[model samples]
Target: MDKKATVQKSGMILPRDLSERSWERIGSSLRELTNSSAWWLADWLIFGEATYGWRRYREAIERTGLDYQTLRNYAWVARRFEHHRRRDSLSFAHHAEVTRLSPPEQDYWLRKAEQQKWSRNELRKAVRASLAEQTRELSPSQSNGDEKQEVTQLSESAGADKRRKVARLTIELSPGQLDYYSKVAAAHGLSVDKWVTQVLDAAERRTA
Candidate 1:
Protein backbone atom coordinates (compact mmCIF):
# COMPACT_ATOMS: atom_id res chain seq x y z
CA MET A 1 0.00 0.00 0.00
CA ASP A 2 1.06 3.63 -0.47
CA LYS A 3 2.30 5.65 2.52
CA LYS A 4 -0.90 7.69 2.89
CA ALA A 5 -3.03 4.59 2.45
CA THR A 6 -1.05 2.68 5.06
CA VAL A 7 -1.28 5.57 7.54
CA GLN A 8 -5.02 5.93 6.97
CA LYS A 9 -5.62 2.19 7.30
CA SER A 10 -3.40 1.42 10.25
CA GLY A 11 -3.17 4.86 11.87
CA MET A 12 0.56 4.34 12.12
CA ILE A 13 3.07 7.08 11.30
CA LEU A 14 5.83 4.62 10.68
CA PRO A 15 5.78 2.77 7.38
CA ARG A 16 8.51 1.00 5.46
CA ASP A 17 8.00 3.25 2.43
CA LEU A 18 7.40 6.53 4.24
CA SER A 19 8.45 9.60 2.27
CA GLU A 20 11.38 11.74 3.41
CA ARG A 21 9.14 14.83 3.59
CA SER A 22 6.56 13.02 5.72
CA TRP A 23 9.22 11.64 8.04
CA GLU A 24 10.83 15.06 8.52
CA ARG A 25 7.47 16.67 9.20
CA ILE A 26 6.59 14.07 11.80
CA GLY A 27 9.98 14.38 13.44
CA SER A 28 9.73 18.16 13.60
CA SER A 29 6.28 18.06 15.13
CA LEU A 30 7.36 15.59 17.78
CA ARG A 31 10.43 17.66 18.62
CA GLU A 32 8.28 20.76 19.02
CA LEU A 33 5.94 18.93 21.37
CA THR A 34 8.81 17.62 23.46
CA ASN A 35 10.40 21.06 23.59
CA SER A 36 7.22 22.77 24.67
CA SER A 37 5.88 22.97 28.24
CA ALA A 38 3.35 20.36 27.16
CA TRP A 39 6.04 17.78 27.79
CA TRP A 40 5.49 18.33 31.54
CA LEU A 41 1.77 17.76 31.36
CA ALA A 42 2.37 14.07 31.95
CA ASP A 43 4.56 14.97 34.92
CA TRP A 44 1.82 17.02 36.56
CA LEU A 45 -0.76 14.32 35.91
CA ILE A 46 1.54 11.69 37.35
CA PHE A 47 2.21 13.83 40.41
CA GLY A 48 -1.49 14.37 41.06
CA GLU A 49 -2.30 10.71 40.64
CA ALA A 50 0.55 9.67 42.91
CA THR A 51 -0.62 12.04 45.62
CA TYR A 52 -4.02 10.41 45.46
CA GLY A 53 -2.80 6.77 45.61
CA TRP A 54 -0.71 4.14 43.85
CA ARG A 55 -3.73 2.66 42.11
CA ARG A 56 -4.67 6.04 40.80
CA TYR A 57 -1.12 6.69 39.66
CA ARG A 58 -1.03 3.46 37.73
CA GLU A 59 -4.47 4.05 36.26
CA ALA A 60 -3.58 7.56 35.22
CA ILE A 61 -0.41 6.42 33.57
CA GLU A 62 -2.31 3.87 31.58
CA ARG A 63 -5.09 6.27 30.73
CA THR A 64 -2.68 8.88 29.54
CA GLY A 65 -0.91 6.41 27.23
CA LEU A 66 2.45 7.12 28.87
CA ASP A 67 4.91 4.34 29.55
CA TYR A 68 5.72 3.55 33.18
CA GLN A 69 9.43 4.34 32.85
CA THR A 70 8.85 7.80 31.38
CA LEU A 71 6.26 8.63 34.03
CA ARG A 72 8.59 7.24 36.69
CA ASN A 73 11.40 9.52 35.54
CA TYR A 74 9.12 12.56 35.77
CA ALA A 75 7.88 11.49 39.17
CA TRP A 76 11.43 10.91 40.36
CA VAL A 77 12.52 14.33 39.12
CA ALA A 78 9.57 16.00 40.82
CA ARG A 79 10.19 14.33 44.15
CA ARG A 80 13.96 14.65 44.08
CA PHE A 81 14.04 18.35 43.26
CA GLU A 82 10.73 19.38 44.75
CA HIS A 83 12.41 22.14 46.74
CA HIS A 84 15.46 22.62 44.57
CA ARG A 85 16.17 24.76 41.56
CA ARG A 86 15.68 23.38 38.05
CA ARG A 87 17.59 24.65 35.05
CA ASP A 88 15.48 25.22 31.93
CA SER A 89 18.46 24.75 29.68
CA LEU A 90 19.00 21.26 31.06
CA SER A 91 16.89 18.46 29.62
CA PHE A 92 15.03 15.89 31.70
CA ALA A 93 17.87 13.45 31.01
CA HIS A 94 20.28 15.77 32.79
CA HIS A 95 18.08 15.95 35.89
CA ALA A 96 17.56 12.18 35.78
CA GLU A 97 21.34 11.66 36.00
CA VAL A 98 21.53 13.44 39.37
CA THR A 99 18.28 12.18 40.94
CA ARG A 100 20.14 9.54 42.98
CA LEU A 101 22.43 12.10 44.63
CA SER A 102 21.98 13.84 47.96
CA PRO A 103 20.55 17.34 47.68
CA PRO A 104 23.89 19.08 48.13
CA GLU A 105 25.57 16.75 45.67
CA GLN A 106 22.69 17.26 43.25
CA ASP A 107 23.32 20.99 43.40
CA TYR A 108 27.05 20.51 42.97
CA TRP A 109 26.83 18.41 39.79
CA LEU A 110 23.98 20.46 38.35
CA ARG A 111 26.04 23.60 38.84
CA LYS A 112 28.92 21.94 37.03
CA ALA A 113 26.56 20.88 34.24
CA GLU A 114 25.42 24.47 33.82
CA GLN A 115 28.93 25.92 33.88
CA GLN A 116 30.45 23.30 31.63
CA LYS A 117 27.51 22.96 29.21
CA TRP A 118 27.75 19.22 29.68
CA SER A 119 25.86 16.82 27.48
CA ARG A 120 23.83 14.10 29.21
CA ASN A 121 26.78 11.72 28.88
CA GLU A 122 29.12 14.31 30.33
CA LEU A 123 26.72 14.90 33.23
CA ARG A 124 26.67 11.15 33.86
CA LYS A 125 30.47 11.12 34.05
CA ALA A 126 30.44 14.04 36.48
CA VAL A 127 27.90 12.27 38.68
CA ARG A 128 30.07 9.15 38.68
CA ALA A 129 33.11 11.23 39.67
CA SER A 130 31.15 12.86 42.49
CA LEU A 131 30.00 9.48 43.76
CA ALA A 132 33.57 8.16 43.71
CA GLU A 133 34.77 11.18 45.64
CA GLN A 134 32.05 10.71 48.28
CA THR A 135 32.91 7.02 48.60
CA ARG A 136 36.57 7.83 49.10
CA GLU A 137 35.79 10.45 51.69
CA LEU A 138 33.59 8.05 53.66
CA SER A 139 36.00 5.10 53.59
CA PRO A 140 36.75 3.65 57.05
CA SER A 141 40.46 3.83 56.39
CA GLN A 142 40.21 7.60 56.38
CA SER A 143 38.83 7.55 59.94
CA ASN A 144 42.06 6.34 61.62
CA GLY A 145 43.84 8.65 64.08
CA ASP A 146 46.76 9.79 61.93
CA GLU A 147 44.69 9.99 58.75
CA LYS A 148 41.90 11.78 60.59
CA GLN A 149 44.33 14.28 61.99
CA GLU A 150 45.84 14.93 58.62
CA VAL A 151 42.39 15.32 57.10
CA THR A 152 41.38 17.71 59.86
CA GLN A 153 44.48 19.82 59.42
CA LEU A 154 44.11 19.90 55.67
CA SER A 155 40.41 20.78 55.97
CA GLU A 156 41.17 23.58 58.42
CA SER A 157 43.88 25.01 56.19
CA ALA A 158 41.64 24.79 53.15
CA GLY A 159 38.75 26.45 54.97
CA ALA A 160 40.96 29.30 56.19
CA ASP A 161 42.92 29.99 53.03
CA LYS A 162 40.20 29.00 50.54
CA ARG A 163 37.77 31.44 52.08
CA ARG A 164 40.30 34.20 51.70
CA LYS A 165 40.62 33.29 48.04
CA VAL A 166 37.04 32.29 47.18
CA ALA A 167 35.16 33.71 50.20
CA ARG A 168 32.53 31.21 51.36
CA LEU A 169 29.46 32.34 53.23
CA THR A 170 26.78 30.21 54.81
CA ILE A 171 23.13 31.10 55.05
CA GLU A 172 20.12 29.09 56.15
CA LEU A 173 16.79 29.33 54.36
CA SER A 174 13.46 27.65 54.56
CA PRO A 175 12.79 25.11 51.84
CA GLY A 176 10.50 27.51 50.05
CA GLN A 177 13.09 30.28 50.09
CA LEU A 178 15.79 27.99 48.80
CA ASP A 179 13.59 26.81 45.93
CA TYR A 180 12.75 30.36 44.92
CA TYR A 181 16.37 31.42 45.00
CA SER A 182 17.35 28.38 42.96
CA LYS A 183 14.82 29.20 40.25
CA VAL A 184 16.06 32.76 40.11
CA ALA A 185 19.65 31.63 39.94
CA ALA A 186 19.00 29.07 37.20
CA ALA A 187 17.11 31.68 35.19
CA HIS A 188 20.22 33.82 35.25
CA GLY A 189 22.40 30.88 34.07
CA LEU A 190 24.14 30.78 37.45
CA SER A 191 24.11 28.18 40.18
CA VAL A 192 22.72 29.21 43.58
CA ASP A 193 26.23 29.51 45.08
CA LYS A 194 27.61 31.55 42.20
CA TRP A 195 24.44 33.64 42.02
CA VAL A 196 24.62 34.42 45.73
CA THR A 197 28.28 35.34 45.40
CA GLN A 198 27.57 37.76 42.56
CA VAL A 199 24.73 39.33 44.50
CA LEU A 200 26.93 39.83 47.53
CA ASP A 201 29.73 41.29 45.44
CA ALA A 202 27.33 43.68 43.75
CA ALA A 203 26.05 44.81 47.13
CA GLU A 204 29.60 45.35 48.36
CA ARG A 205 30.47 47.41 45.34
CA ARG A 206 27.38 49.56 45.77
CA THR A 207 28.28 50.13 49.43
CA ALA A 208 31.86 50.94 48.51
Candidate 2:
Protein backbone atom coordinates (compact mmCIF):
# COMPACT_ATOMS: atom_id res chain seq x y z
CA MET A 1 0.00 0.00 0.00
CA ASP A 2 1.27 3.44 -0.86
CA LYS A 3 1.07 5.53 2.34
CA LYS A 4 0.45 8.82 0.44
CA ALA A 5 -2.29 7.20 -1.65
CA THR A 6 -3.82 5.61 1.48
CA VAL A 7 -3.90 8.95 3.30
CA GLN A 8 -5.45 10.72 0.29
CA LYS A 9 -8.00 7.91 -0.23
CA SER A 10 -8.95 7.97 3.46
CA GLY A 11 -9.54 11.79 3.25
CA MET A 12 -7.76 12.23 6.57
CA ILE A 13 -6.73 15.67 7.69
CA LEU A 14 -4.00 15.60 10.30
CA PRO A 15 -3.98 18.18 13.11
CA ARG A 16 -1.10 20.08 11.57
CA ASP A 17 -2.66 19.91 8.13
CA LEU A 18 -5.99 21.18 9.47
CA SER A 19 -4.29 24.04 11.26
CA GLU A 20 -2.38 25.04 8.13
CA ARG A 21 -5.50 24.87 5.95
CA SER A 22 -7.52 26.90 8.43
CA TRP A 23 -4.78 29.55 8.67
CA GLU A 24 -4.57 29.85 4.89
CA ARG A 25 -8.30 30.48 4.59
CA ILE A 26 -8.27 32.96 7.48
CA GLY A 27 -5.20 34.75 6.17
CA SER A 28 -6.76 35.28 2.73
CA SER A 29 -9.92 36.68 4.29
CA LEU A 30 -7.90 39.00 6.52
CA ARG A 31 -5.86 40.33 3.59
CA GLU A 32 -9.03 41.14 1.68
CA LEU A 33 -10.67 42.78 4.68
CA THR A 34 -7.57 44.73 5.65
CA ASN A 35 -7.41 46.47 2.27
CA SER A 36 -10.55 48.43 3.09
CA SER A 37 -11.59 47.88 6.71
CA ALA A 38 -8.39 48.51 8.64
CA TRP A 39 -8.49 52.28 8.33
CA TRP A 40 -12.19 52.39 9.12
CA LEU A 41 -11.68 50.19 12.15
CA ALA A 42 -8.79 52.34 13.29
CA ASP A 43 -10.93 55.46 12.94
CA TRP A 44 -13.75 53.85 14.94
CA LEU A 45 -11.38 52.77 17.70
CA ILE A 46 -9.90 56.23 17.90
CA PHE A 47 -13.34 57.76 18.31
CA GLY A 48 -14.20 55.28 21.04
CA GLU A 49 -10.89 55.92 22.78
CA ALA A 50 -11.33 59.67 22.71
CA THR A 51 -14.90 59.43 24.00
CA TYR A 52 -13.99 57.07 26.85
CA GLY A 53 -10.32 58.09 27.45
CA TRP A 54 -6.77 56.83 26.85
CA ARG A 55 -6.60 54.06 29.46
CA ARG A 56 -9.34 52.06 27.75
CA TYR A 57 -7.90 52.68 24.30
CA ARG A 58 -4.35 52.01 25.45
CA GLU A 59 -5.35 48.55 26.71
CA ALA A 60 -7.03 47.67 23.40
CA ILE A 61 -4.05 48.83 21.32
CA GLU A 62 -1.51 47.03 23.55
CA ARG A 63 -3.53 43.80 23.29
CA THR A 64 -3.44 43.99 19.48
CA GLY A 65 0.24 44.99 19.26
CA LEU A 66 -0.77 47.84 16.97
CA ASP A 67 1.02 51.17 17.02
CA TYR A 68 -0.89 54.01 18.69
CA GLN A 69 0.55 56.53 16.25
CA THR A 70 -0.93 54.59 13.34
CA LEU A 71 -4.40 54.66 14.86
CA ARG A 72 -4.09 58.33 15.75
CA ASN A 73 -3.21 59.20 12.15
CA TYR A 74 -6.13 57.17 10.82
CA ALA A 75 -8.50 58.95 13.16
CA TRP A 76 -7.09 62.30 12.12
CA VAL A 77 -7.58 61.55 8.43
CA ALA A 78 -11.09 60.25 9.07
CA ARG A 79 -12.09 63.36 10.96
CA ARG A 80 -10.26 65.91 8.86
CA PHE A 81 -11.46 64.67 5.50
CA GLU A 82 -14.63 62.80 6.35
CA HIS A 83 -16.44 64.08 3.29
CA HIS A 84 -13.77 63.12 0.77
CA ARG A 85 -14.59 59.79 -0.84
CA ARG A 86 -11.31 59.72 -2.79
CA ARG A 87 -9.37 59.04 0.42
CA ASP A 88 -9.99 55.31 -0.04
CA SER A 89 -7.64 55.36 -3.03
CA LEU A 90 -4.55 55.83 -0.85
CA SER A 91 -3.03 53.67 1.85
CA PHE A 92 -2.90 54.63 5.53
CA ALA A 93 0.76 55.60 5.17
CA HIS A 94 -0.07 57.86 2.25
CA HIS A 95 -2.79 59.66 4.17
CA ALA A 96 -0.69 59.82 7.32
CA GLU A 97 1.97 61.67 5.35
CA VAL A 98 -0.46 64.53 4.69
CA THR A 99 -2.08 64.73 8.13
CA ARG A 100 0.15 67.67 9.01
CA LEU A 101 -1.36 69.74 6.21
CA SER A 102 -4.54 71.76 6.33
CA PRO A 103 -7.61 70.16 4.80
CA PRO A 104 -7.21 71.84 1.42
CA GLU A 105 -3.53 70.98 1.22
CA GLN A 106 -4.23 67.40 2.28
CA ASP A 107 -6.80 67.03 -0.48
CA TYR A 108 -4.40 68.55 -2.98
CA TRP A 109 -1.58 66.17 -2.08
CA LEU A 110 -3.89 63.16 -1.96
CA ARG A 111 -5.17 63.93 -5.42
CA LYS A 112 -1.62 64.32 -6.65
CA ALA A 113 -0.67 60.97 -5.10
CA GLU A 114 -3.61 59.18 -6.66
CA GLN A 115 -2.98 60.65 -10.11
CA GLN A 116 0.77 59.96 -10.04
CA LYS A 117 0.60 56.60 -8.27
CA TRP A 118 3.42 57.75 -6.00
CA SER A 119 5.17 55.40 -3.64
CA ARG A 120 5.30 56.41 0.01
CA ASN A 121 8.86 57.70 -0.27
CA GLU A 122 8.03 59.74 -3.37
CA LEU A 123 5.01 61.20 -1.61
CA ARG A 124 7.22 62.02 1.35
CA LYS A 125 9.67 63.90 -0.84
CA ALA A 126 6.83 65.81 -2.52
CA VAL A 127 5.27 66.73 0.81
CA ARG A 128 8.60 67.92 2.14
CA ALA A 129 9.25 69.98 -0.94
CA SER A 130 5.83 71.58 -0.62
CA LEU A 131 6.46 72.37 3.03
CA ALA A 132 9.88 73.85 2.33
CA GLU A 133 8.45 76.03 -0.42
CA GLN A 134 5.76 77.30 1.92
CA THR A 135 8.29 78.02 4.65
CA ARG A 136 10.49 79.95 2.23
CA GLU A 137 7.53 81.98 1.01
CA LEU A 138 6.36 82.77 4.54
CA SER A 139 9.76 83.82 5.81
CA PRO A 140 11.79 85.28 3.00
CA SER A 141 13.89 87.33 5.41
CA GLN A 142 14.86 84.28 7.43
CA SER A 143 16.18 82.62 4.30
CA ASN A 144 18.17 85.77 3.51
CA GLY A 145 20.11 88.30 5.62
CA ASP A 146 22.85 87.45 8.18
CA GLU A 147 21.79 83.81 8.63
CA LYS A 148 22.34 83.08 4.92
CA GLN A 149 25.68 84.87 4.96
CA GLU A 150 26.86 82.88 7.99
CA VAL A 151 25.81 79.55 6.43
CA THR A 152 27.53 80.39 3.10
CA GLN A 153 30.73 81.41 4.86
CA LEU A 154 30.81 78.35 7.12
CA SER A 155 30.16 75.93 4.23
CA GLU A 156 32.63 77.50 1.78
CA SER A 157 36.26 78.58 1.78
CA ALA A 158 37.99 81.57 0.07
CA GLY A 159 38.24 81.44 -3.77
CA ALA A 160 35.71 78.60 -3.97
CA ASP A 161 32.65 78.66 -6.28
CA LYS A 162 29.46 80.10 -4.73
CA ARG A 163 28.20 76.50 -4.54
CA ARG A 164 30.05 74.65 -1.79
CA LYS A 165 31.24 71.08 -2.34
CA VAL A 166 29.36 68.52 -0.27
CA ALA A 167 31.26 67.20 2.72
CA ARG A 168 31.16 63.59 3.91
CA LEU A 169 31.07 62.57 7.57
CA THR A 170 30.71 59.20 9.24
CA ILE A 171 29.30 58.33 12.65
CA GLU A 172 28.22 55.20 14.48
CA LEU A 173 24.90 54.87 16.26
CA SER A 174 22.96 52.09 17.96
CA PRO A 175 19.96 50.69 16.08
CA GLY A 176 17.52 52.54 18.33
CA GLN A 177 19.30 55.86 17.84
CA LEU A 178 19.45 55.35 14.07
CA ASP A 179 15.73 54.59 14.00
CA TYR A 180 15.00 57.74 16.00
CA TYR A 181 17.17 59.81 13.69
CA SER A 182 15.38 58.46 10.63
CA LYS A 183 12.02 59.32 12.16
CA VAL A 184 13.19 62.86 12.92
CA ALA A 185 14.45 63.24 9.36
CA ALA A 186 11.13 62.05 7.94
CA ALA A 187 9.21 64.42 10.21
CA HIS A 188 11.22 67.36 8.91
CA GLY A 189 10.78 66.16 5.29
CA LEU A 190 14.56 66.06 4.90
CA SER A 191 17.09 63.50 3.79
CA VAL A 192 19.68 62.39 6.37
CA ASP A 193 22.25 64.62 4.64
CA LYS A 194 20.02 67.71 4.72
CA TRP A 195 18.89 67.07 8.29
CA VAL A 196 22.47 66.65 9.48
CA THR A 197 23.52 69.78 7.61
CA GLN A 198 20.73 71.76 9.26
CA VAL A 199 21.67 70.43 12.68
CA LEU A 200 25.30 71.42 12.20
CA ASP A 201 24.24 74.78 10.84
CA ALA A 202 22.08 75.42 13.89
CA ALA A 203 24.94 74.49 16.17
CA GLU A 204 27.25 76.86 14.36
CA ARG A 205 24.75 79.70 14.66
CA ARG A 206 24.41 79.09 18.36
CA THR A 207 28.16 79.20 18.86
CA ALA A 208 28.74 82.26 16.71
Candidate 3:
Protein backbone atom coordinates (compact mmCIF):
# COMPACT_ATOMS: atom_id res chain seq x y z
CA MET A 1 0.00 0.00 0.00
CA ASP A 2 1.00 3.63 -0.49
CA LYS A 3 2.19 5.61 2.61
CA LYS A 4 -1.09 7.51 2.76
CA ALA A 5 -3.08 4.29 2.51
CA THR A 6 -0.99 2.70 5.27
CA VAL A 7 -1.52 5.68 7.58
CA GLN A 8 -5.27 5.65 6.92
CA LYS A 9 -5.40 1.92 7.60
CA SER A 10 -3.46 2.34 10.82
CA GLY A 11 -5.87 5.03 11.96
CA MET A 12 -8.74 2.62 11.31
CA ILE A 13 -7.15 -0.19 13.35
CA LEU A 14 -8.34 -0.11 16.95
CA PRO A 15 -5.81 -0.51 19.77
CA ARG A 16 -5.42 -3.94 21.29
CA ASP A 17 -5.11 -4.82 24.99
CA LEU A 18 -1.34 -4.21 25.04
CA SER A 19 -1.59 -0.67 23.69
CA GLU A 20 -4.40 0.04 26.14
CA ARG A 21 -2.30 -1.29 29.00
CA SER A 22 0.69 0.88 28.07
CA TRP A 23 -1.45 3.99 27.77
CA GLU A 24 -3.12 3.25 31.11
CA ARG A 25 0.24 2.85 32.84
CA ILE A 26 1.67 6.07 31.40
CA GLY A 27 -1.52 8.05 31.90
CA SER A 28 -1.99 6.89 35.47
CA SER A 29 1.61 7.76 36.32
CA LEU A 30 1.18 11.21 34.84
CA ARG A 31 -2.17 11.81 36.53
CA GLU A 32 -0.96 10.66 39.92
CA LEU A 33 2.20 12.83 39.89
CA THR A 34 0.80 15.88 38.16
CA ASN A 35 -2.77 16.03 39.45
CA SER A 36 -1.90 18.45 42.26
CA SER A 37 0.46 20.52 40.11
CA ALA A 38 -0.45 23.49 37.95
CA TRP A 39 -1.67 22.87 34.41
CA TRP A 40 1.74 23.93 33.06
CA LEU A 41 3.52 21.42 35.26
CA ALA A 42 1.30 18.63 34.12
CA ASP A 43 1.87 19.61 30.49
CA TRP A 44 5.67 19.63 30.92
CA LEU A 45 5.70 16.27 32.68
CA ILE A 46 3.74 14.70 29.86
CA PHE A 47 5.77 16.28 27.08
CA GLY A 48 9.17 15.64 28.69
CA GLU A 49 8.25 12.07 29.41
CA ALA A 50 6.82 11.49 25.94
CA THR A 51 9.74 12.95 24.00
CA TYR A 52 13.26 11.49 24.10
CA GLY A 53 16.15 12.72 26.35
CA TRP A 54 14.59 12.17 29.76
CA ARG A 55 17.79 10.88 31.34
CA ARG A 56 19.64 14.16 30.75
CA TYR A 57 16.65 16.14 31.95
CA ARG A 58 16.47 13.95 35.03
CA GLU A 59 20.14 14.63 35.76
CA ALA A 60 19.58 18.36 35.49
CA ILE A 61 16.63 18.09 37.85
CA GLU A 62 18.59 16.00 40.33
CA ARG A 63 21.71 18.21 40.35
CA THR A 64 19.86 21.49 40.63
CA GLY A 65 17.51 20.39 43.42
CA LEU A 66 14.89 22.34 41.52
CA ASP A 67 11.72 22.46 43.53
CA TYR A 68 8.58 21.19 41.88
CA GLN A 69 7.62 24.75 41.03
CA THR A 70 10.95 25.51 39.37
CA LEU A 71 10.78 22.27 37.45
CA ARG A 72 7.33 23.30 36.26
CA ASN A 73 8.72 26.61 35.02
CA TYR A 74 11.60 24.88 33.22
CA ALA A 75 9.05 22.64 31.52
CA TRP A 76 7.17 25.71 30.39
CA VAL A 77 10.32 27.23 28.84
CA ALA A 78 11.36 23.94 27.25
CA ARG A 79 7.90 23.59 25.84
CA ARG A 80 8.16 26.99 24.19
CA PHE A 81 11.62 26.29 22.76
CA GLU A 82 10.53 22.90 21.46
CA HIS A 83 7.34 24.39 20.03
CA HIS A 84 9.15 26.84 17.73
CA ARG A 85 11.89 24.35 16.91
CA ARG A 86 9.34 21.74 15.89
CA ARG A 87 7.34 24.24 13.87
CA ASP A 88 10.46 25.25 12.01
CA SER A 89 11.75 21.63 11.97
CA LEU A 90 14.88 23.15 13.37
CA SER A 91 17.15 21.08 15.54
CA PHE A 92 18.09 22.64 18.86
CA ALA A 93 20.36 21.16 21.50
CA HIS A 94 18.97 20.40 24.92
CA HIS A 95 20.15 22.52 27.86
CA ALA A 96 23.69 21.23 27.85
CA GLU A 97 27.20 22.73 27.59
CA VAL A 98 26.02 26.01 29.16
CA THR A 99 26.49 27.86 25.90
CA ARG A 100 25.13 31.39 25.75
CA LEU A 101 22.62 32.30 23.07
CA SER A 102 23.44 35.01 20.54
CA PRO A 103 21.53 38.30 20.91
CA PRO A 104 19.30 37.61 17.92
CA GLU A 105 18.55 34.04 19.03
CA GLN A 106 17.71 35.30 22.50
CA ASP A 107 15.47 38.01 21.13
CA TYR A 108 13.70 35.81 18.60
CA TRP A 109 12.96 32.88 20.96
CA LEU A 110 12.10 35.09 23.90
CA ARG A 111 9.69 37.09 21.79
CA LYS A 112 8.24 33.85 20.46
CA ALA A 113 7.67 32.43 23.95
CA GLU A 114 6.23 35.70 25.24
CA GLN A 115 3.84 35.96 22.32
CA GLN A 116 2.58 32.37 22.57
CA LYS A 117 2.77 32.04 26.39
CA TRP A 118 2.32 28.34 25.85
CA SER A 119 1.90 25.61 28.43
CA ARG A 120 4.05 22.50 28.12
CA ASN A 121 1.72 20.33 26.04
CA GLU A 122 0.53 23.21 23.90
CA LEU A 123 4.17 24.02 23.22
CA ARG A 124 4.80 20.42 22.25
CA LYS A 125 1.74 20.45 20.05
CA ALA A 126 3.04 23.58 18.33
CA VAL A 127 6.38 21.88 17.82
CA ARG A 128 4.61 18.88 16.28
CA ALA A 129 2.59 21.26 14.14
CA SER A 130 5.66 23.21 12.92
CA LEU A 131 6.59 23.09 9.25
CA ALA A 132 9.04 20.49 8.00
CA GLU A 133 11.57 23.23 7.38
CA GLN A 134 11.53 26.96 7.98
CA THR A 135 10.45 28.69 4.76
CA ARG A 136 13.42 31.06 4.74
CA GLU A 137 16.69 29.71 3.45
CA LEU A 138 19.11 31.43 5.78
CA SER A 139 22.86 31.73 5.51
CA PRO A 140 24.90 31.19 8.71
CA SER A 141 25.39 34.94 9.21
CA GLN A 142 21.77 36.09 8.78
CA SER A 143 19.81 36.39 12.01
CA ASN A 144 16.41 37.46 10.75
CA GLY A 145 15.03 34.57 8.71
CA ASP A 146 11.95 36.21 7.29
CA GLU A 147 11.50 34.58 3.86
CA LYS A 148 9.52 37.60 2.62
CA GLN A 149 12.72 39.67 2.77
CA GLU A 150 14.18 37.66 -0.12
CA VAL A 151 11.02 38.01 -2.22
CA THR A 152 10.81 41.68 -1.40
CA GLN A 153 14.43 42.32 -2.31
CA LEU A 154 14.05 40.54 -5.64
CA SER A 155 10.57 41.78 -6.58
CA GLU A 156 9.95 45.19 -5.01
CA SER A 157 12.29 47.27 -7.23
CA ALA A 158 11.19 45.42 -10.37
CA GLY A 159 7.55 45.75 -9.44
CA ALA A 160 7.95 49.47 -8.73
CA ASP A 161 9.69 49.95 -12.03
CA LYS A 162 6.92 48.13 -13.85
CA ARG A 163 4.23 50.06 -11.97
CA ARG A 164 5.94 53.34 -12.82
CA LYS A 165 5.84 52.46 -16.51
CA VAL A 166 2.04 52.07 -16.49
CA ALA A 167 -0.15 55.07 -17.33
CA ARG A 168 -2.22 56.23 -14.38
CA LEU A 169 -5.92 56.91 -14.81
CA THR A 170 -6.94 60.55 -14.61
CA ILE A 171 -10.59 61.36 -14.04
CA GLU A 172 -12.13 64.76 -13.53
CA LEU A 173 -14.33 64.85 -10.40
CA SER A 174 -16.92 67.50 -9.73
CA PRO A 175 -16.66 69.24 -6.34
CA GLY A 176 -19.75 67.43 -5.04
CA GLN A 177 -18.50 64.01 -6.14
CA LEU A 178 -15.06 64.64 -4.62
CA ASP A 179 -16.65 65.62 -1.32
CA TYR A 180 -18.87 62.50 -1.38
CA TYR A 181 -15.85 60.27 -2.18
CA SER A 182 -13.83 61.78 0.66
CA LYS A 183 -16.67 61.23 3.10
CA VAL A 184 -17.12 57.60 2.02
CA ALA A 185 -13.39 56.95 2.25
CA ALA A 186 -13.24 58.48 5.75
CA ALA A 187 -16.25 56.40 6.85
CA HIS A 188 -14.60 53.19 5.66
CA GLY A 189 -11.24 54.05 7.32
CA LEU A 190 -9.51 54.18 3.95
CA SER A 191 -7.37 56.61 2.01
CA VAL A 192 -9.13 58.19 -1.00
CA ASP A 193 -7.15 56.03 -3.45
CA LYS A 194 -7.98 52.84 -1.56
CA TRP A 195 -11.59 53.92 -1.32
CA VAL A 196 -11.70 54.38 -5.08
CA THR A 197 -10.18 50.94 -5.59
CA GLN A 198 -12.72 49.40 -3.27
CA VAL A 199 -15.56 51.13 -5.07
CA LEU A 200 -14.26 49.90 -8.41
CA ASP A 201 -13.89 46.37 -7.00
CA ALA A 202 -17.49 46.40 -5.72
CA ALA A 203 -18.73 47.61 -9.08
CA GLU A 204 -16.84 44.86 -10.89
CA ARG A 205 -18.24 42.22 -8.55
CA ARG A 206 -21.75 43.46 -9.14
CA THR A 207 -21.27 43.38 -12.90
CA ALA A 208 -19.79 39.89 -12.73
* Among all candidates shown, the one with the greatest TM-score: 1
- Per-residue lDDT of 35-64 in model 1, one digit per residue for the tens? 444337545765677587878767766887
C-alpha displacement of 41 in model 3, angstroms? 62
Model 1, residue pairs in steric clash: none
Least accurate 10 contiguous residues by lDDT in model 2 = 145-154
TM-score result, candidate 3: 0.21
lDDT on C-alpha atoms for all candidate structures: 0.62, 0.61, 0.43
Question: Arrange candidates by lDDT, highest first: which order?
Answer: 1, 2, 3
Report, for all candidates in order, the number of backbone clashes. Answer: 0, 0, 1
Ranking by TM-score: 1, 2, 3
171-191, model 2: which lDDT tens digit per residue? 445545545665576566453
**1 versus 3: better lDDT goes to:** 1
Of candidates 2 and 1, the better by lDDT: 1
Off by over 4 Å in 1: 1-32, 35-42, 50-52, 140-208
